[model samples]
Every structure is written in structure tokens, then in C-alpha cells.
Target chain A: MAYALMIHPTDNVAVVTEAVRPGEDVLYEDANGGQVCLKAAGDVPVYHKIALRDIAPGEQVLKYGKTIGVATAPIAKGEHVHCHNIESPERKELI
Target chain B: MEFYGYRRSDGRVGIRNHVLILPASICASDTAEMIARQVNGAVSFHNQVGCSQVPSDMQYALDMMAGLAANPNVYGTIVVAAGCETCQCGMVMDAIAARTNKPLHGLIIQKEGGTIRLIEKAVRLAREMAAEASTLRREKFPVSELILGTECGGSDPTSGIAANPVIGKVSDALVADGGTVILSETTEFIGAESILADRAKDEHVRRRILEIVERYEQHFIRNGENVRLGNPTPGNKEGGLSTLEEKSLGCIHKGGESVIQAVYDYAKPIPTDVKGLVIMDTPGNDASSIAGMLAGGAQIVVFSSGRGTPLGSPIAPVIKITGNDATFRMMEDNIDFNAAPVITEQKKPAQLGEALYKMVLDCCDGKLSKAEALGFTETAVMRACNYV
Candidate 1:
């Protein structure tokens, strides 16, 4: 089965093991080591991120169990997560 | 726990014994290369900076040049200069002498009448030095004498998950073995300072960790640019890394879980008394960062690259490892090890780390790495500022 990898249980995104076309079902190992399936809502490049859960605008995007970036717009489950929807911020506004 | 290495007069063990044709300035670089080509077991690098600049910038070039010559990997050095450069041959010789009492000689292009004459003289000196270098036999040394430089570049998501973790395991093992490991690239530590500081051995190191990151970011911030705005560079973004934080979190994995014992300035000598993990303030640029570590006396570098790179050091062997299965297969000629099975076959990172550790031992015992075999000796030294 095509798969993605959820690096941490708290991570809202998982990295795709291979490219996924829209509507394709991709499997991912959950934090508990159990496999879960999600249908991709959009295409994602290989090694790119896929939304594991719905994310609202301005909310931090978690990967490696930490804030990798913040969403600039709504990100739906199984949607491709990348620069178009995210911004790597300075965290605390520059002094 | 033991590897065969050349025992230097300075009491340091060297994994390689090449004679170095040192260039004191950019003007002398080609001459150094020309001399190196004629002498077997001689190595030289293209020096981009030497004749320019403010005192601080000139000092960096001087330190790096001397450090490369003083690196235990070389049996001797023949410093070549254009005579009128800011970094004079005599100054470089003094710097090298401050670090090691190894065999040393100097030649000036103007004094020798030009490139051809200088190369002729340097080639003869290098040939004699190479002969002496060849006489040394590899002797057994404990792993504790080794300093491992850890770096990651051309990274993708797979690097953090597989390759860096595998290197992390090796870092931990080397620390456990009482060997020194250098965690460099301060520019990559932006979003993960707290995590690394948490692993510091004491308040001093923890404070230094924060200071170096602040200093690096401020250099950009003071110039009206935010480092976070552009990091996770174009290649990093294409490789699935989204933020400086994500990249940093991955980059820190190369340090394993060892507590940072100390932090050294760029191109400064890594004190021999220090053991375990230390951090060197360096840029994120692969060649420059690796060059800083090598200058600090690292005998070997284990670099993890998910997007793949051919970076190597002239003085030390750089063992390239990749976690991306496709990249490894595609760049088999450049990459030295593959950590892809961690994802493809679900093998443990620790297991792969043991295998990589053995490869490091083999490299130290005189096995040429892919980079060494291909003769990729790209190097760069970090500068304080532009030419004055």
C-alpha cells in the first residue's frame, strides 16, 4: 500500500513516502504503530507533507512533533502541505 | 575501539599522511595546486581569501590556513605565497608553528621569480616531504583520540528520520567511547536552541549555545533581513523541509543526544582536553561548515545528505550518507552509506548506526571514502566581513 510516515503522535502532518495523486488512499503508521488510511484530497510530491487532520488559518503546523511552520490558510485533511499554504515565521516577531 | 593511524610528533594520531602545499593567498592557490599535482601524496585547496581585508577577516583566513596545515592528517606543509599578500608566508608559518611542530617550509612567488620558479621549488620541497610522510607506518590508537565532525546538508525529510538519526546513534556511541564529536552549523540551530541548550552539560555551555545562535541571527537581523524568512532554502523546501525550525530539529539529530561539552569559535583549535560533544560556530553552507570543523582538528566527518552532495575536505575524509533511497541509488558514486532501510524496510536506526560506525573505523584505518576516491576536496572558510 502507498504510505506516509507520521513522525510523532502530536504531529498534524505526515510525510508521504511516495507521490500521491488526488483521491488516492494512502496508509500511515500511527503513533501506536497501527496503520491508518486517509484519502488524499490533493496531489502531494514525494517526501512532501500531507495534512493528517484539519488545520485552521494561523494555526501552527506541527512536524517532528514541533512547530515547523504556520498555516497561512485552511488546510483540509489529506491536503498537500507546503509553501503555498505555510510560512516559516520568526516565531517571536523580530525585536 | 582501535584504528590504525599515523602517530604525529605532536602526539595526535592522523588517519592520512599527505604533505600539504599550503597557499597563503588567492594569488598562490594555483601555484600550490600545480606543485601538489607533481608530488604524490600532496594535497592543496583553492583558497578564495587571503590577500584582502580588515584584520578580523584576515585573521579568519590565517587561522583556517594554519589550521589546515596543523591538522594531524598532514605530515608536513610547504607554504606558498605571492610575497605582498596580507597573509604573508612568514605569518602563516608562525600560525602553524603555534599549533604543531610538524615539518614546515615556505616559498615566495616574488622572491622565487614567479609561479614557475615557485612551483619548481615547492614541488621539490613537497616531494621530499611526501617521501618523509610515506615513511610513517600506521600505528594502533584508541578511538578516544578521534574527533568526529557531524553535519547535514542538501536535506530532505528522510534525512531527519533516517540518516541523521543513524548518525545520531553513531555520535552517541562515539561519545560513549570517550571520543570527541563536533556539532556545527550554528545557522541551522535557529528554531531548536532550547532543545539543544537543554542537552548542555552546564549553564556555561547552555548560555554559549544561545549566544552563538543569537549572534548569527543578529548578523542577518541587523542588516534588515530576517533569517527565518529565507531559510529552509529553495532546495530545502523542495525536499519537504518547510521551516528553519524543521531543518534545525533534523540537523540537531546529527549530534545524537549527547550533552554539548563546549563551544568553540570558528576555526579555533579544539582543545585536546575536551571530550564528548562540542559545538563549533559555523555557517550552514556545507563546504564552509565542514571546513570549520576540520580546522578545529576533526580527523573525520560523517555528513548526512538527503538531497545529496559531493562535498569533501582536503585534510579529512568526509563519509557521505543518505536516507533517501532514490538519491542513494542515483548518487551511489558519491554517497558512502545508505540509511534508507530505516524507512523502506523498517530497520532500526541504531542498527544502521553500528554498521556506519564500523565504516568510520575502516575509513580511519586507511580506507578511502567515495569523496576521497573521487578527489572532491571543496573547502571554504567563514569570513567576518567583506574586504576592507
Candidate 2:
């Protein structure tokens, strides 16, 4: 019910505005006038993102209504999104 | 909207009232500081150059000294010199006179007999100027009277996403209201120069933008460093920025969407009535760049950072904003506003931009920024190395 933020309509993730511990309940608006329960998969800090839906490899990671990066592998909903899975193409090219 | 500010004799408005003690060269710096200490409202910088080689470099120092005096913030100035420096006190005083008819006094250490004698003369003159400055009062001035400077440093990934864009929005708003905004840091515009050129008001301005970037690249080449290989610094890489191009793209966003009006040399005062966004050719060093803008007559500065820095100028107040929420939390004492909400909470950049614009008005009306509160009056004057 707390620490949830909808960053953009096109974004498949919502950022965690404050630190949220693993197993905490994050209630979000669902399509059927019901609250969908999302359990945090790991501790997330402010400005970090959480997967709103199952993301597949190579799928564009949207934030601020733009593609911030592409997911490198399948990420479960509520899992923390960061360098481990989402990597900037520019950085990838540098490697 | 309008804010209360001191109106200068040259028709420019100043956000702060100051009595400036300017050193004509390194030898006069100590005496200038002594004068500032004796006078209640006087401030001086530790100038390290002025007696050097090339005429161009000497002229640069001389122009900056005069520019600082001509800057609207100072009601009057006391020019101190060693009598034989490349930047002579008389030349500096003449430059200030040409710019404004405001009260200006000159003192030469060599001509005045000794350091103690020069200091005594300077302190006496500075006190008279400070008293004269105190009599002047602030009047309501339109927002269009402001010439705002936009600069960013210690950039991280969130800087491109939040802080820069918020400043872009503020730039657009100010331009729409008929104000002038100056965007500098030629090195940061390397990869994105073409995009900005495309936005230029004409072909000449566009070509000049590219020329300035290329000139900076040549400066690096002369120094024996590849521009690309040295950019997107180690800290930037750690913060998720990958290449120089990516950083350049984000950096240009702070200039907003206005058509580029003109480009200028470092520390030269901009032509009044050139309302819109302009660019100044300056190095990427934050302190030097901000100093150039302040000398060029920017009444206030809006500085963005991802890794926060507590930088301010003795004359102009610097408002610090940050994009990274973590950095903001870690360095809350240094940062003035948080733009992380734009990324973390989906707050529109416009909302933060409006807030920053209102804060600028408040700052002009005598509100002290976080940098001012922390007493971070940092200053740096650019110089060239020379051998005798």
C-alpha cells in the first residue's frame, strides 16, 4: 500500500520512491476495481524501479514514458530492476 | 511577475548589493583582501594572474577584472594594483568607467609607497564606496530583466533524466517571458553540437557552435589527449552513463528548446536585448565556467548536479538542484531542490520547473540559497602557465 509510484503510463514498472523491504505488500490499481498485491522480491531504495509485469529478454524497459534500456533476461514482477538485468545500450557497446 | 532588486547606473538590475575590492594582479591580491576585511560590505578574490607574457592572456585577466566590477551585483569597486602588472589599474578603471558611470576608485601598491600605505588608501576608499552603495535601494523589476545561467556538474545517470530536463523547462519558461538564458561548457556539447546547430536561428550561429566544439577538441589534441577517450569520466560510468555521446545528449537538454541566438567569448558581457538562449565558450570546469558566466553579467545561476556539490560565488547566488534521490538524501545539506521526484514519483518536469522559477524570484528578492547559507563562495580565475 506504500512506497509505490507510477512513473509513466507506458512504463511496465513503477519506481520505489522510498526503501521497501522484501515481502512487503505493494497494492496497485488493477483493471477490475481491485487492488493487485505485489510482494517485493528484494529491498529497493528510492529512485529504483520494480517490475510491474513479467518482462522478457530484449523488451524495452520504459520509464518517464521513454525506453530507458532493454531487459537482458526474464525478470519476475516485483523484482528490482537495475544493472543486473536492465543495461543501457551505450554501456553494452562500451563493453 | 517582478522582484525587488538594485538598479544599476547602466540600466542593469542586480539581485544582491555588494562593494567589490578587485585585485589588478597576484601582487595586489593580499592588499585587496586587507581592504575587504577593513570594509564591512567589500569582497575580493585571490587573483593569481596579471603580470604575464602574451597580450591575449593579459587582456583576458584585465577584461575579467573590469567585468567583475561592471557586474550589476557590485554598486561600486576599488581597483588595487602593483603599478607594473600587465593588467594596469588605470586600464581596469577605464574599462569599468566605459561600462558604467558607477563609483570606481584605484590604488597602486608601488606608486603608493608600500603595502601598508596601499592598504590604508584602499580601506579608506572602500569604506566611502560601501557607504555610497548603502544609500541605493531596491526597486521592483520585471522577470525579463534577469539573465540566468544554466550549468551542470558531477553528472550521474539521473542528471539526464530529471534535473537537466527540469532546467530545460525553466529555460523555456524564462525565454517565453522575454528573459535571456546562457548555456556554456563547450566540451559537454561535443557529441550533441549538430543537434543544437540544427536549432540555431541561422547558418552563422549553427556553424559557430560546431566551430567552438571543434576548437575545444583541438585544445585537447594540443594537450596530447583524445577527447573521446577522456570523457564520460569514471564516476559517470559508475552511475550508468556509458559514452561521451550519451553524456553530451543529456547535457544539451539544459539549454531548452529556444533557438540559439549567439555565442560569445569567455567573460565578455552579453549584449543587452539579446533575449533568448545564448551560448558562451567556456571550459567544462564548474568553478571556472560559473565564474565566466558571473563575470558576463548573470545575476543568478541555476546549477544542476547528480553528485551534489556545494559551489557558490561571492557575488551571484547559486541554486543547487539534484536528480538522484539517494544523492539528495546523502547530501541534503548541499542541494537546494530535489528533481528525483520527476523520476521516482512521475512528477512532471514542468512542476519542478515552475518551482525552480519561483525560487529564482525569491532568490532575487533576497532569499539565501543553500550554497549561500553554507558560505560556499567559491571562485576560480582561468590562467595560462608561463616560464620566465
* Candidate 2 Cα deviation (angstroms), residue B262: 1.1
Q: Which candidate number maximizes lDDT?
A: 1
Which DockQ values do the candidates obtain, in the order shown? 0.58, 0.08
Best by DockQ, which number? 1
Error of 1 at B290 (Å): 0.9
Tell me the tens digit of each residue's lDDT in model 1 across B353-373: 999999999999999999999
CAPRI grade, predicted model 1:
medium
Model 2 residue B58 distance off true place after TM-score fit, in angstroms: 2.1
lDDT digits (tens) for residues A1-95 of candidate 1: 47999998999999999999999999998989898999999989999999999999999999878888899999999999998998875455222
The local distance difference test score of each candidate is 0.91, 0.80
RMSD after Cα superposition, model 2: 5.5
